[model samples]
Target: MSSSLVVQDLGFAWPDGDRVFDSLSFTVGPGRTGLVGLNGSGKSTLLRLIAGVLRPASGTVHTAGSLGYLRQDLTLDTQMPVDELLGIADTRRALQAIERGETDVAHFTAVGDDWDVDERARAVLDRLGLTHVDLDRRIGQVSGGEAILLGLAAQLVRRPEVLLLDEPTNNLDRAARTRLYEAVAAWPGVLLVVSHDRALLELVDQIAELRDGEIRFFGGGFSDYEAAVEAEQETAERLVRVAEADVRRQRRELIDARTKLDRRVRYGQKMNDTKREPKIVMGNRKRAAQVSAGKHKTMHQEKLEQARERLVEAEEAVREDDTIRVDLPATEVPAGRTVLTVHARLAHVGHQVDLLVRGPERIGLVGANGAGKSTLLRTVTGELAPAEGSVDAAVPLRYLPQRLDLLDDRLTIVENVARVAPDATPNQIRSRLARFLFRGTRADQVAGTLSGGERFRATLAALLLAEPAPQLLLLDEPTNNLDLTSVRQLSQALEAYRGALVVASHDEPFLESIGITRRVTLPT
Candidate 1:
């Protein structure tokens, strides 16, 4: 069977008025491919379309395989054993039936070659870093990450012709992410993945970027896509300038032609003051003059219309091709000499380490899942408060939590930001929201209705509105819903920021790019 997927002119919208997909289209084959886009940009929706779980609003999706998808929406009873979730025994039978073309698409039953299925299922389970998950253990007893691994094992056992995974590495650690890259790199089947992990994208053969309601394919990896986008930005700026000038010139030419035509019409209307040779001659002259005037006016109007069309085209080029602006308005804060000092602070998980910070230090907190990373960040921010040791926070601090709870769920974005810092005026709030790309009419949209990325931005915008920027900024998984381009923009903003930067993220490149030189390693 051929291993490939073809999606054409796909689009989908929610019944509630949100547009989930807008003319998304792409093709994939039997190789590693990465799907990168902002959260709610329909990356997951597109995967569902290909998986046949969700139908497109108006397009065709053709798949050439027995499909398997690992969505984050996996629902497993906590009390169920992980082995049962894997369906190891059942998957074995399914593979056996497929091998002989014995099972119809409608149902599956165990008859022959059942033992072979078990062996294949075991091999797949082992490959997914689940070598230690006992086939008999209940999954409810394991971590969220572990449950996903079991789900992955169940899917891979089928040896599907096509596989679609969304946010597969979200709950994984550094080591687990590495193992996933290695596993897919050697796999021989069509793979479509949606992930925020840059490390994973580097292993893919092609990159499909979903942005601005369109899908654009780049032949190379993520690095290539970055460079290509940069080149495009440069080209777009140059073209916009050219278009602006041409539009102005066309408008001026159109005005000049209109002025000349008006003068001719005035001259024709005021004629007949001069004596004519005879009555008939005079009549003919009058008729000829009117005909000339009519043709001249018609041609002049046509030229004006043509010039106006050119201007429209130029403006469209400028509006549609402009570069994305990621600038953040960060204030230079007057921080205290000491931001935070941890005295022999021990993590709740017993990683067994002390963390100390002096002045404005750009630090990164990183560890595998189930590690004490979040716990440590909370300690630093005075949220959990050290249970066993002395902690000191010398400056005003603000924490950007992983799950944003600070934002008001019911208020409009403008109202929420306004409610946070009640001192700011409406005009000031409008100006601030615009910086985060929620300009004009969007400011009034309900905060709860916004997408993850937009919600994150709204919270950040409020943080910036503080009277004095928090001398210390603590961010938790800030890049989760952000696209790579948006992340780069945030990175640039952080690079320009002067206050202390404390970030907890799985994005190694983003941390490195943001000038994080020191590490407060959270214990595993």
Candidate 2:
């Protein structure tokens, strides 16, 4: 059967009167579509509305055939058996009861048309690269990446015609991500996904961008969408230039008209003073000249105003996603300079990690979700003592942890930076903060009310702008929830910082974007 999803005249608002979307309409046909947007552009909210997880204030969602949805934050029961996670525990139990000589009608009813359910579950799990995970095992025994795969298997077992996935690659490792990507490529049904992972988005058939409470669809993958946007922006900028030129021409014309009116006024006054004609004739000529002058002045003024309005409209059509700019001389590291060393035995990473970081080298820590990456970072930062061995840093160090809990929520953005850099005056701090896109009153707003991207920027500003600038920076899963543009912005900011960087992440494209020079792999 043909499958599709449609949204019509959708409107939603928060209880605090913050309008998220209004009069939005879009459609998803039987193909893979990737949704892209900025942090607060309501991508996730739109998915929720279609998945029936959230109620809309107005309008409706229509879907043909059965539907399935996988949200970013899946609530898993650790104690539940693997069979339960695959959504086949009841059918398996009925088969067991029948094998034990039970002749109850309820057993037959439970096993109706699904006598082969157990075999199908095993096959699906194997296909999703979970061959080692047995149906009898508990969910707690497997790693996080395996758990996410199991979630996908559960949705596939139902064979729904329409599927919605939100950030499905958030915690998957590289190898596991490849398995999920393969599954997405083979899905022969309507699929819609929201993700920042470039590799995953590359597999989609089309791209849907949600911005300013509207949906715009582009043909092909991420690269195609980027090309289309660049072309559109170039056209918009050209229009702005044309409108600016028109405004200048109108201003010049208005000035020339004013000058001509002044000269005519003097000539009329001179004719009256010299009595060049009869008194009535001179009076009539003077009144006519004044009326004509008023009309000409009004026409030129109106034309200038209209030209300026067109310029404003043309400029508004262009988008400006500002980037950060900072110069930290103290953060630079000389070539061949020793930076840090780690010789520790982590709890999950069995092998003892002994390595040296020098100069401005970038290191990427790659591993599965439960492979002790965060633990190693904490150990390196002295937040958690290593189970064994030693770690040392020769330069100033700062760690941007996975949770980004470094800032004080009650304090304003400027105050938060000030707390970290006590020597810098408020004016100096504000001036530096503006480079991170926290200018004017935005810097004075309390940190508790910031959106995800804003909070990330504020945290980054506090870390980079602190006194005694850090020469070695550590980041954990920095691109987990950031939009693609924000990820690019982060890469740009890091490009300006001449310091050693150690990042722990599952995003391969982002890791490549930051120029990783070395790799550290942990055992699964």
Candidate 3:
């Protein structure tokens, strides 16, 4: 059978009674499909269900052929050898045994017809930019980016008919991303990927957006999907305006009809009181008038109800793109003020760096996976002392680490922000948190319970809302693991910041979106 994946009437819910999907269904043929959604919209869960990593509550997932899956978290035993991770260690051992003249049928069975498994594994590794990675090396010895690549390499070596990748480009640098992109572009199977990386999304043949408990397939890549959505929103907004006008017109007409009926009744009563016509004739006229008025009122009421329904439907069509909006005048530094200075060798990479930041300058810190970009950011924030130099900051600064560990997991979102801004009242903190899209009771959610996107927003809110205000900000891979919307929200939040910024990131598009003033690359 041709490679295909089909899901029929899929239903899933968490054990906590949180329903994620109900009767969701979609099919994938042999081509690249990029799955996208908001942070908790069940994209990952859907992929897991399809891959059989998680059992579905209901419905059936059918695959035509073999399947390979690369999960986002990529948890693995650090002590495992690279060959084992690549899934060729046993085959290689079997092949070696046969070469040693062992007359063992089990060894031949293990080897099968794949005597060149090691060579194929090495080729796949090399294709993903892991040429230097030895098969016998421990997984712990590789960088995080390399480990992600290795997982992909392992999947590619299996040559499955269907492949599912979730957030494959999370920690990959530009070069590694390029290599992965090439691999994705060349895949000849039913490939479905869940990712927030715009570049990776652009490589897909089509876009599948999971939203509001449903999946919507759009022709072409991310750009095409965006254009279609923009057009749809425009039409929806126009319809909403038309519906509102119709409702208003109906209301006015209803009021006019009521006024006319009241005037007619009063005129007829005055005439009857003056004995202008017989009592029976006047009574009959009054009853007929009452019936006419009721019909007119009911007609107008039905028209108004219909108009209101249309308005609601039109409004629903328009998507809500909530973004961060804030004004941080307190964080503004003087035009010529020295915000930060660092003159020392980075501890991890032993790279010499001399940097001076002034005013509200924005700097993008970029390097390979093991180039110590995080180390340099820590040194700038005084979190880690420089190996051979002194660091100075003229004003208060805040750091947002890659792991988003700044917030206290036990504390509520409001409490976390309040911890940083001690002088601000609970109400004051909540009012500001609203600008970060945490309104009402949402601010009361514990940090530990928040999704990846929520935690990023909460951490950012706390960082910017701190006491005395931060005049400088240091962010390490701030866009890592964030959804596309959250990344855009982060950019929106940073746009309002007046402080000097030193951001370490592998996401070049994000750095550009946030308007980086200059780029500094650390040596490997």
Candidate 2 lDDT tens digits, 423-515: 999999999988999889999999999988899899999998877899999999999888888888888888888889999999999999889
Quote each prediction's TM-score: 0.85, 0.95, 0.94
What global local distance difference test value does model 2 have? Answer: 0.90
Which residue pairs collide in model 1, if any?
78-140, 81-138, 81-139, 82-138, 82-139, 92-117
Write the number of the candidate with greater TM-score, choosing between 1 and 2.
2
- Ranked by lDDT, the better of candidates 1 and 3 is 3
Candidate achieving the largest TM-score: 2
Per-residue lDDT of candidate 3, residues 73-126 (tens digit): 999899999999988899999898999999799999999989888888989998
Pairs with backbone N, CA or C atoms under 3 Å apart (clashes), candidate 2? none
Ranking by lDDT: 3, 2, 1
| Candidate 3 global TM-score | 0.94
Predicted candidate 1, C-alpha RMSD: 4.9
lDDT score, residue 82, model 3?
95
List RMSD in Å for every model shown: 4.9, 1.9, 2.2
Residue 269: error of model 1 in Å?
A: 4.7
Query: Candidate 2, residue 444: CA error in Å?
Result: 1.9
